[model samples]
Target: MAKSKFLAAASHDLRQPMQSLFFVFTALERHVGTDAGQALLERLGQGLGALKDLLDSLLDVSKLDAGAIVPELADVPIGPLIDETAACFAPAAAAKGLRLLRDAACDVAVRSDRTLLGRIIRNLMENAIRYTEAGEVRIRCRPAADGVRVEIADTGIGIPPEHLDRIWEEFHQIGNQERDRSQGLGLGLAIVQRLSRLLGHPVEVHSVPGTGSVFSILLPAASRPLGAETRRTGPAADRAGDASGLGRVALAIDDDAIVLMGLRSMLEDRGYEVLAASSGDEAIAALERSGLTPDIVVTDYRLRNGQVGTDCLLRIQEFLGRKVPGVVLTGETGQDIVSEIVALGFGAAHKPITGAEMRAAIERQMARHAGASASPVPEESRVAEPA
Candidate 1:
């Protein structure tokens, strides 16, 4: 309990700066024209991404420890999931001169939670590519006696026999004693282990110190074969080529001046007319002064003077005599807090959110609000606040 609280507090503080930097970098991406400058920026972006990954790993551990992740089992086709995950990491493998191979012919389906299973595959593949300095990383699916075995094989520096079991422990890196961020924070396998256990999947690892390593997961076969599966794309994919905020007015509030500035800049870049503020009163005042109804509201979850984003959003809606699409930006990962935010009929996004992610959240909320406007107010939004 003490450790979780400390981790949450530290993460909240660190994510503020990371969020500001993300917004700044997104706004800067369009200005770099020279090849050399672009390359430097890309390297910086990779480093930033690594930092974000490490923080996310910490949050995952905390969430798992808190029993916040509940699995929803279904018939998950293995082929398409592997294909999508492989596509995401193909660039990383190519950058390291490693071949990423997959058994695309396998059409087997497994009964498991798709998101959790995909996370397992992703962590294993990331771990494989990180340790392997040469050769190829291949993912193969084969039939097992009672289930299917998905294996990731890598030809690089293999793990020692004695350290095989210890590798699953948190912050236990094989060769990285210096705690290099580039190599990773050593939390990937820890997360994989926790998630695999949660999903009732068994994990296995074998390595020859000088040759290579292979990691496998055993998943139960689906009772029935999969029918035609439609890929589940999140809000980002739905608005892939249409990220423009043209003619849309947005009201943003944040206590941190830097974060507020970054938000304003990012929204402006997306062609939004922004009304920015640092507090609820300021936001209301700005709205009244502008005499323009904002199409969306974006605010930090915790604000100055004991103000919360949900209340601020509701207050704004009350003043305008209508519900406006709102997205609450927070650094808190407590499940109760998240559930409360969702109960308020507002979209929720964790801190250190990238520019693209923020855009997606805004669009998703706006789309939901548009759909709900034609009907009565959602019952969830009318629930009384918890004491």
Candidate 2:
């Protein structure tokens, strides 16, 4: 517990500067136009991306160890969730010249936390794709007596029988004795084990030395029908290109000046009219001075003077005399914080957000509230999962 808490606090602090670095990178990406400069920038982006991935994994491990994540069980439709997750990895799989396939998932509903389950599937898919050199990665879903069984199979290097048990241990990887970061930090399966245990899902693995491997998880089937509000919510990478916030007004709130400046620059670069503020009062004043209502509200979860992003969003809505699409950004992994952000109909994303992530979050909220005349808060909102 002590170690977990310490890591969590340290990771939270690290995310601040990490976010600033991402902002700086975003601002810099627009200026380098030459092929050589772009190549260097791409290399730099890869390094930064690797760093971000490591930090995110470490944060997940610490949060899970500290029991900071709570599963919000729901009747999540397996088909859409699987399809959406698979789509996100399509680009990566294609880059490796591997075929990614999903068997026609039946209209099966699972009784589990949707977000956690998606994470489990994503981690397994990523592992399969990373370890595989050629052939294909396939996903299948079918009805089982125990529950709905979802399996991901890969034509990659298989695990040895003796080492199967140790794969769930942290930093355990086969064939990669050099500890290659490209092979991943070996925390994906560890996270999968912890999440499966928390959700009471049974995970099974089968493999042969050089042929391939299969990973499966059995989720308890939901007896009730799917609710009207139940739907897939995640980063639409395919649609991100069209999610430009052009000609729209965006209000960005954060206490950190560097983050605020970087964010403003990034958004302005994306062709949005941005109003940046360091606090609730400043935000309100800025909005009032602009004499233009904002199309979206983006704010950090924690602010100076003991304020929270949720309260600030509400205050803005009250001041505007209507509910506006909002997104809450934070590095905190506590369930209570995430729950509050979602329950209030605000989109949520972890801190150190990239320009793509921020834009996706904004696009999602705006689409959700589009064409409504000051619609009340929706019943459920899914936070943006890690890319």
Candidate 3:
């Protein structure tokens, strides 16, 4: 079967059984206060974690083959991505009595896909922690040649030299151990390999037979502001900013129910009063029926009737008698479509979106209309920082 078809069918079918099992596990765990029962819950959590890893790896392979994966370059603080990844893996390490340290003291920046870069470092970190039964896992960022080099180093039972080259190959695990068997489908490094290649970067690994291993990814210098660091040291707890502003009603449109629910919850949680619609016609009717003026319209780039987001935005703007800020989200939007989006005065965000990237995109909209007021409530007459 085609990888695309495999993914669509498998993800759909997998979710049903997994979600059902998840609920049952949750219910059973809730009723069991004993340590033995708690062990079952812990094991169940690990199983779910493993299942998610498999799904993500499968999707990564498919995306890479289809050439659907690419870098999203933006001005980002160097410390933030490392910090966020460290925070995510800290609990897992703590559970194993392992120390996680982040030496992200470059006080600099790098131009790269922040999300994908984060994922690469994160996979390395998780794999490091998973393989090691003791000591620490550390992430370090430093200035390299013209860009930056990030290292995820773990003091674990290191890989033998014979196995080093083969490890980054697809589904390859270094050692034949019970621990290695349970942690992943051996796709962590494969993801790192695919992402690095796609982004025109390279990841280098150094490991001793029994001491430790260090994996490094290098990239170019950053171009813009390095604001909003989400390290544990920062005061911006949760750091995921709100999407609401100036009474803008963003239309959340997607055919996938899970994506719809997650995005709607995420947007609403960020304070946007979202109008969810699964189809383009429904999205248009939503605007007409609510008798409400939309401040900004956000829709999935693909709609059910094969209508593109540009088409829907055009129709809605025509109905409103003016152009509104539009943001299109997509799973796979080609380069040509991106040019069209920009030409149509819209912005695009590709999935799966991080809280920070989503906020950044929305802020672009806010910044665009910041000082100018609208009728629903005139845009803030106050001055906004220049883009």
Candidate 4:
């Protein structure tokens, strides 16, 4: 209840400045055409980006509570994840005169959840971009025996050591006095810390008052052989070749005809042979008689007749004999709902969906399922006993 009020108040307060800033920057970009105006517009853009990050962090927190946050762990190339995240903030970093640099050795693939990791780094980078008035933001990575340590070091206003411990706490803030009056302060780091804990990764910070700050994340090592797996391990597959079987019999069960149609279209466009079931009973009947075995299940979180998406996925996976991948795509974003989704350990994507994002989510599910078994599954093998 308190969180609700805080969110409402925060939204109303923050959006006001963000909207005004957007318009002012847009107008300035259109008219001034001068270098000075360009710089000012860039500054406004950074401010706006910071504001957006704060709000996004809030939404993520709410989603986590609602059980909508799901982690689909897969073999992801460490380099691309960092590169993509860094690219997203490059403009903001440049506008602040920060030289953003990244270092990588070989393509190290790790068994980890990509979206959450991306968000974690993004939170730190966004903060680095926001607080640092000068100097560079450098990302350094080195492989550990079992995991890897990735660091985001920024030459900005160094965090006080006492503040470092508190920074990861929910709703904790340090230097955003101005931004706080308008919108928020502590949400981003809190979100980061929460996600890191969920993924079982350790986050560390080192800062000297006048020098700079370095935030490091230690993640489990990627499982990749130095052979064909290396070439294939670079996050290019739907599921590791071993797990591609899951999407072969993909199922979309939703009561909403529009949702069913949309999911069908999405699957068809992505070249997945999709089967639709309108209700839990129908889905059960179809699976009981027919030889249709689902490799992956994608369903709406809410369905008619009080049958939830979680129940449906659980039932079908139980039937499949082999463990299969599942994703729940929904429109609801309350924290409890999101938390339930996350606790189930499926990929959760919010609705009002974009085609690309939907496809990407499916691909991640597939790859994750594949990478779960480093030892290849022979093409003709169903080695496991039937459930």
The digit string of per-residue lDDT tens for model 4 on 1-387 reads 578557644643454344334333443454567898788777777666676656656657765554456688877667777877778899988887889888865367766788788888888888777777888888888787778888999888888878878877776667665646333467778888778878888898899887889888988876654344444433444433332333476788878675576666656555567678887667766778667766667887877867778777766655554556778865554556667776766788754344445566776776676656423323333222224
lDDT of 1 by residue, 174-272 (tens): 988999877889899999999999999999998999789999999999878766653343223445334678998999999998889888888999999
lDDT of 4: 0.68
Q: Ranking under TM-score, best-scoring first? A: 1, 2, 3, 4
Residue-level lDDT tens digits of model 3 in 38-116: 9978887777767755765776776676675657776556676777788899899999999999883666667777678
After the best TM-score superposition of candidate 1, give how far the Cα of residue 227 lies from its true spot, in angstroms. Answer: 2.1
On lDDT, the stronger of 2 and 4 is: 2
TM-score of 2: 0.86
Q: Which residue ranges in model 4 land beyond 4 Å of their true spot? A: 1-55, 65-68, 180-185, 226-331, 334-387
Q: In candidate 4, residue 337 scores what lDDT? A: 66
TM-score of each candidate structure, all chains considered together = 0.87, 0.86, 0.63, 0.52
In candidate 2, which residue ranges exceed 4 Å CA deviation?
104-107, 224-242, 374-387
TM-score of 1: 0.87
lDDT of 2 by residue, 64-148 (tens): 9988888889888888888987899999999999999999855768899988999999999999999898999999998899679
lDDT score of residue 266 within candidate 3: 54
